[model samples]
Target: MDYALKESSTKFETILGTALKVPGVRVDREQFLLQTLGSKIKDGNIVNLAIETDPVTAGIPIDKLDKIANSLIKKRTTNTSMLSFAAGMPGGVTMAATIPADTLQFFGTAIKLAQELVYLYGYGEIGNANQLDEDIRRELTLYLGVMLGVEKSAAALRVLSTNISKQVVKRTSRRALSKTTLYPIVKKIGAIVGVKVTKASFAKNVSKAVPIVGGIVSGGTSYLSMKHMGHRLSETLSESIYYTDADYEKDFKEVCNEVVDVEFN
Candidate 1:
């Protein structure tokens, strides 16, 4: 992939953002686990993120970053409400068991990662699912084609699609168990869009698959919007810890965006 650096960075952030989604104060313990003792999660892989982005274009401007960060804080507070209705949990035990201390750490990391991504790719309306999809696809295409190259574009799109799709599943599944109901619809819509955008080699498959996918995408988008809102919250909180924007200023140790532009073995 020509955009090997960019792809590597994207994956890095996705993994890392999960860690960074927490508040700074909470990150200390997990940071120690990740960086010092080197904690490993489900697999042998250390549950830490390594991310890199261009300083000039990768970090959103301070004002916009502040707006984004603040929004995320609000969303986190709101997401807490979901816990009230969480049938899955018995009580304090569920929150304690399901919501790990490390989640806060990941939340903080997720925020910083969002900052870099929003900096590189502008934020879009959370209300409009189609718009979000288009925005993501457009950005991925440009970033891959212009900055990275063809192979990278495909890879980036796949990654972006997969990531967004995961969010869609996460968000929507919370409300309704069967997002599969949307598959046929998304697949049809996907065909319409695919016919125009897809190249010959992959066009037929895309045409067949997209509407079913697109429909599910449409239905699941509400949750995706919430996830984006959560992401925005994470970013906002992380930035507040760093930059002293009057709108979102906070007292904490600032972490600079570190660049890690190497291929993972």
Candidate 2:
């Protein structure tokens, strides 16, 4: 397809919003943990496990989750690459202001992979409500930001994760995800995404990879890209601390201030 992602915060934000609304796109923490844990975890106990503790501390094996996560990444990468390949078929046309099918699919899979990784690492769902509330959206943005290599996003997530673990709740209501606190961070992340993905790099590469005649080049590129991103988030969540309330309070203030101070056009 001729459509190339533009260098604009609006576009990136729109993509983020759209990717999130897709049916069944967001992974349910309890459901995922149960399925992932399989029979090893007693049915009734598994559901509470997500709210009370993370997967590892609950005795869910890290190796098992890692292996499953790899399979998921590979599967999603392959699926997206195939779509990219199809879109580049000899007669495929690129339309202006249009988002590529491959790009959309990539975000969907990325979000899916992200949620799974968090669940496997022992964090609860970002948001499981019927609506995409501001709180939920903020968390999702942070996840995408982390995937894109934004340090501030990771910091905020660490705070959110620690808070969520402490509460025994389905989600974190911490100000870390509040609009006031996250707006600047969100904008900064958008700018970063715009710079990182804007037709300049991601598009140019994909457009070139899938030549007039479709090929596996683009697919290979996607596989590596998705794997890299998945690893970043997985590593981040794994290392997040759930230790002390005082540490969280200190970290929370610093992260919120730093994120707020960051500016993005």
Candidate 3:
């Protein structure tokens, strides 16, 4: 069992590393969006913005997020030159590898969407890749899990929400979230997704045996999968209680208990 856990952990780390390395998708724009939205949240400008504009003052409207996510996914998948850039490489690299590359790009898109959605829903910056703060990383990980439709992530979010409502400092919130107890849940979520992505890649690769047909198949798969994941995340983040109020302690405690009761293995 210990060996299995270690193997799963290693596989998840490798996949995550590849996903993080996918280039072309921009992070600066998302970070800037977070900064702008953060300011709006601080100044209570959301109400005024909503009053002036449509009903979407706090965060980007779900419909708009959907459209943007679709557009980004399309751009990433439809660019044949970009998709095939690493396909023709010598020795050991083949069309099968492109699926993971595309999957990584999709994850990059998902991360950007997560950041934007989190900010829109009123959470502050959890730091970026360059930051070494474990607390911030842990917090971000919880959000990522939520975006990926992990049930435990929802419980963790509720707990974090409760903490924030009580005026918990970012550091303290991070500390609570970074508890050794929660590590397995986080790892489990990552491992599950890694396995899913790997399996999906293999299935997609079978369809992609022919290079020309493979590009189309891979692009379509990336497009549909990304759209599905992005929309799921947008819906979950958009309905956050943080958007309305911070009095979520009771709710958070309930969720924390439920999360604690969940046996990971």
Per-prediction TM-score: 0.20, 0.74, 0.63
Q: Which pairs clash in the backbone of model 3?
A: none
Model 2 lDDT tens row, 18-59: 778777677877677666666445655654664467766655
- How do the residues 1-265 of candidate 1 rate in per-residue lDDT, one tens digit apiece? 1344344434433423333333442222233323422221232232332112211123334464355435443454344334322321222222233233222232333333333343322232221345554344343232223121222222222223222311111222222212243222222222222232223213222332455543233224323333554443334333322322232111101100000111121
Between candidates 1 and 3, the lDDT winner? 3
Model 3: lDDT to the true structure: 0.51
Give the residue spans of candidate 2 off by over 4 A: 1-7, 39-54, 90-97, 130-132, 160-163, 166-179, 200-214, 241-257, 263-265
What's the best-to-worst order under lDDT?
2, 3, 1
Top-lDDT candidate index: 2
Predicted structure 3: clash tally: 0
Identify the runs in model 3 with alpha carbons over 4 angstroms from their true place. 1-5, 21-26, 29-31, 34-99, 128-137, 161-178, 242-264
lDDT of each: 0.30, 0.63, 0.51
What clash count goes with each model? 43, 4, 0
Winning model by TM-score: 2
TM-score head-to-head 2 vs 3, winner: 2
Stretches > 4 Å off in candidate 1? 1-59, 84-265
